[model samples]
Target: MKQFTYVITDEAGIHARPAGLLVKEAAKFASSTTIAKGAKKGDLKRIFGVMALGVKKGEEITVTCEGADEDAAAAALEAFFKANL
Candidate 1:
């Protein structure tokens, strides 16, 4: 398993557009990806699950990827958060 923590910088938070993109990105990997805000976690591949967390700007979240492509998935997710979230 691989994990990274990130603070959201987008003013809109994990709203529809970016959340949709995030789900799509997570689906690209073979690993199981999860995003957690405090004790609440959601599958990164599921749009509704992610949105349910209500992640907001400046809030910290941890992303975990486990499985065959964990390394790459973690790196990509980190970059994705930096670039888009």
Candidate 2:
């Protein structure tokens, strides 16, 4: 598994649009992806699951990936968060 942390930079945090984009990006990888805040973790491919986290701007979250494409998944996700929020 690979893990990286990122802070939400957008004012709206991980709202519908970005969350949807994240889900789409995550789906492209064969690796299992998850996002975590505190002790809560959810599948990154599920829009509702990501939105339900209530991530806020400046709040940090950890993304983890496992399976065959874990490294690529982690890099893509990191870049997405960096570019989008």
Candidate 3:
């Protein structure tokens, strides 16, 4: 498993568009991706699950990638977060 923590930079947090894009990105990897804020963790591939967390701007989130493609997945997500979230 690989993990990293990031503070959301967008004012709107992980809203609809970015969340949808995130799910699409997560689905590309063989690894399972999960993001957590506080005690709430959501599958990165599931839009509703991610949105349910209601991640707000400036809140730190921990992202974990696990499985065969964890390294790639983590790297991709890190880039995605920087570009999108």
Candidate 4:
């Protein structure tokens, strides 16, 4: 498994559009993906799970990848966060 934390820079945080986009990006990977904020954790591939986390601006979230393609998934997602989050 590979994981890293990101502090949301978007004023709107992970709202609907971004959440949907995130789900799509995560789905492109073979690795299982998950995101966590404090005690709350959600599957990154599931839109509702991501939205339900209630992540806010400047909040730290840990994105985790596990499975065969975890390394590539982690690298791609890191870039995704830089570009989108």
Candidate 5:
């Protein structure tokens, strides 16, 4: 498994558009991806799950990836967050 912690930078937070983009990115990997915030953890490939995290700007979150291609998934997700929050 691979994990990365990131602070959301988007002013609007992880709203519908960003969440959808995240889900779309997660779907490209063979590994299972999850986004966690506080006590909540949800599948990264699911839009609702991503939105349900209620991730706000400047909030820290951890993204974990497991199974084959986890490294790539983690890297991609980290890059996505860095670029899009």
Candidate 6:
């Protein structure tokens, strides 16, 4: 498993459009991806699960990827968050 923590930089946080894009990005990986805020964790490939977290700007999120493509998945997700969230 690979993991990275990031603080949301976007003023809108992980809103609808970015959340949707995030889910799509997670789905592209063979590894399983999960996003966690404090004790709450959600499937990164599920839009509803992601949105349910209510991630506000400046809040910290930990993304974890586990499986065959964990490294790539983690890298991609980190890049996505930096670019869009």
Per-residue lDDT tens digits for candidate 4, residues 12-65, read: 999999999999999999999999999999999999999999998999999999
Q: Give the alpha-carbon lDDT of every model.
A: 0.96, 0.96, 0.96, 0.94, 0.93, 0.95
The digit string of per-residue lDDT tens for model 5 on 1-85 reads: 8998998889989999889999999999999999999899999999999999899999999999998999999999999999988
How far out, in Å, is residue 15 in model 5? 0.4
Q: On residues 8-44, what C-alpha lDDT tens digit does candidate 2 reach at each position?
A: 9999999999999999999999999999999988899
Model 6 per-residue lDDT tens digits across residues 1-85: 9999999999988899999999999999999899999999999999999999999999999999999999999999999998888
lDDT-better candidate, 2 vs 4: 2
TM-score of each: 0.98, 0.98, 0.98, 0.97, 0.97, 0.98
Candidate 5: lDDT of 66?
98
**RMSD in Å for candidate 1, one decimal?**
0.5
Give the residue spans of candidate 5 off by over 4 A. none
Q: List the residue pairs that clash in candidate 5.
A: none
* Local accuracy of candidate 1 as per-residue lDDT tens digits, 1-85: 8999999999999999999999999999999999999999999999999999999999999999999999999999999999997
Worst 10 residues of 1 by lDDT: 76-85
Model 3: weakest 10-residue lDDT segment is 76-85
Q: What is the lDDT of residue 58 in candidate 6?
A: 96
Number of colliding residue pairs in each model: 0, 0, 0, 0, 0, 0
**In model 6, which range of ten residues has the least summed lDDT?**
76-85
Comparing 2 and 6 on lDDT, the stronger one: 2
